[model samples]
Target: MFNLIKNEWIKIFSRPGTYVMIGLLVLLVIGAGSVMKFAGVSQEPEGDWKQQTQMQIESDKQYLEEMGGSENFQTQYYKQQVAINEYRLANDIEPASGESIWSFVNFNSNFVEIIGLFAIIVAAGIVASEFTWGTIKLLLIRPISRTKILLSKYITVLLFGITLLLTLFLLSTLVGAIFFGGGDGQPHLVYIDGAVEEQNMVFYLIKTYLLKSISITMMATMAFMISAVFRSSSLAIGISLFLLFMGGTATQFISMKYDWAKYSLFANTDLTIYTGAMQPLVDDMTLGFSVTMLIIYFVIFHLLAFIVFKKRDVAA
Candidate 1:
């Protein structure tokens, strides 16, 4: 299995496109860091964090009053922010004030979407390209079972995705440190259950990275399944990108009026909602429930992909 996975890994990196993807990631990291430095995105607060927190709370409260009994999504979001800012001030916790490695990674978590897109591209091509290039027979002629071959390819795709994610994190951290200096062991302020708490910056960043990667993983799996079943890399990539970019927005809109939206795959994939960064669309949604939903969808995707690949005839 190790040897097979290694071979598959080699095959992935052998493609020029893989190197291009890595290059793009590096450029993006540097570009974002430069932009932050030049645009004053990392300016330090003039007053104490408590003062800043108070000002934020007051501003949000005034906005809430202006909102005047409108319980729309935007109002709820502002209310949540007010609660969090108030908690920060009361607990003497520092609100995020300036740019640092921690802040950079936290903000750049959005780049995980880029990583996801790259992973989808790889996954969409991994299997279908074998068929497109007439390499499936060459792969199967080896001394391995069909299951092993499929597993190796899948494993390699996951490793590639993980590699890109780590590269993003590490590169962003290095660039951030170069520009903003070290964090001096700052703590991330988190608001949960009507309380403010402190968590280690590194730990929080790691958790954030993992949670963000979940959406990428699910999207890649879907792409991989489509590639295997349809044997068309273009089709697989196109459909997966559409879902990656649009599915979440569509789910959010549907969730506004429908309870069933809670069970949608997109709804469950973003585990960050449970971290108190935002509220769940449904009041009853919980970490455990979202995790369960993800597991179910993950299993279904893998089962379909594996079953189809295993039963497929290379001779055809």
Candidate 2:
């Protein structure tokens, strides 16, 4: 299995396009960092911390009142923000006053979507390209079982995705440190279960990135499954990319009216909603429910891919 995965990795790196994708990611991060550093983009709020906190609290309270004391998700979110801000003021713990390395890192987390795009592209092509180029027969002629071959390819795709994520995290951290100095030792504050909590900045950032990557990973898995089943890279890439970009929006629209939308892959892909950062799109969607939904989808995707690949006729 190790040797197979190594071979697959070597094949991916042997292509010039792979390097271009990686290089593009690096350039984008650096460009963003440069712009943030030189364009006078203010990462910190202006005015005295106490005044700002008080104003924010007032704003949240007003919004809540305007919500007519409803128990909706947005109402709950604003309440949480109010609580956290009140805690900040009562404890005399001012927020970070200036842009720091951690701030830049958090900003760069938006680029994780781009990473997902690239990973989906790779996943879409990895298996389909073998059949498109008439290399499936070559692979089938080997002594290895079909299941092992497919598993190796899938594992290679996952490893590639992880490599891109780590590269993004490490490169963003380096660029952030170069442009913005080290962190100011402020703990990330959150309001959980009606109580405020302080979390380590570095640990929070790491967890945030990982949670954000969950959607990307699921999309890549879907692309892989499509590639193996259809044996057409273009088709696989098109469908997966479309859903990757639009699935959440469509799901959100549906969720506004239908509670069943909570079972959607896109709805559950965002695990961060469970982390106290935001409210779930649909009520009653818990972390355990989302995880269970994701696992079911994951199993179904792999099953379809393996079953189709195992039975596919390569002799034609």
Candidate 3:
């Protein structure tokens, strides 16, 4: 398995396109940092944070009153905001102020989507390309079982994805530190079950990045499955990329009128919804439920890929 994975990794990095994708990711992070540094995007507000907090509390209260009796997601959002802001005032914990390394890292979290895009591209092509280039015959001619080969390829794809994520995190941190100061040691305040909790900023950022990767991981796995089942990288990439961009929006639209939408892959992909950051699409969806759903989907995708690949006729 180690040798197989190593071979697969070598194959992935051997291509110029792989380097291009990585180069693009690096350039994007640096470009974004440069833009924010030069555009005078101040992370700090001018007035007293206490005064600003009070103003925000007042605004939220007014909005809540205006939205009374209409209990929906927006109402819940305002209520969460009100609770968090009030907690900030009561605890005298000032909101994050001034650009810092942590702040820049948080900002760069948006680039996770780009990482997912590149991963999906790689996953979608990895298996299908073997067949496309008529290398599957040579690959299967080895003494290794088909399952091991497929697993090795899948593991390699995962390793590649992890490499991209780490590059993003580390590169963002470097650029952030260079452009912004080290950090101000601010605690990340999170609202949970009607209470605000203070968490280590670094730990919170790392957790945030991991949570955000769930959707991408699923999409990449699905792409890999498609690639294995159908010997066409173009088709696999097309479907995966399309859903990667539009699946969540379409799922949200359906969720507005249908509670069953909660069972959707896209709906549950965002585990952050369970963190009280926002309301779930369905009122009853919980973290446990989403995790279970993801596990089911994960198993199903792998089962389809492995079963098909093992039984597939390569003699043609």
Best by TM-score: 3
Model 2 Cα lDDT, one tens digit per residue, 1-316: 9999999999999999899999999999999888888985575777698998899899999998888967876788889989989989988889887677898899888999998998898999999999989988998999999999999999998899899999999999999899998998988998766688999999999999999999889999999999999998899889998998899999999998899999999999989887778888887888999999999999999999999999988888
Off by over 4 Å in 3: none
TM per prediction? 0.94, 0.97, 0.97
lDDT of 1 at 12: 90
Number of clashes recorded per candidate: 0, 0, 0
* Whole-model lDDT per candidate: 0.87, 0.91, 0.90
lDDT of model 2 at position 183: 91
lDDT of 3 by residue, 1-316 (tens): 9999999999999999999999999999899888889985576788799999999999999999998778787898888988989988998888877778898899898899888999999999999999988899999999999999999999999899899999999999999999987987767877777777888989888888899888779999999999999978899889999999999999999998999999899999988776667888888888999999999999999999999999999897
Sorted on lDDT, best first, the list reads 2, 3, 1
Give the per-residue Cα lDDT of candidate 2 at 260. 98
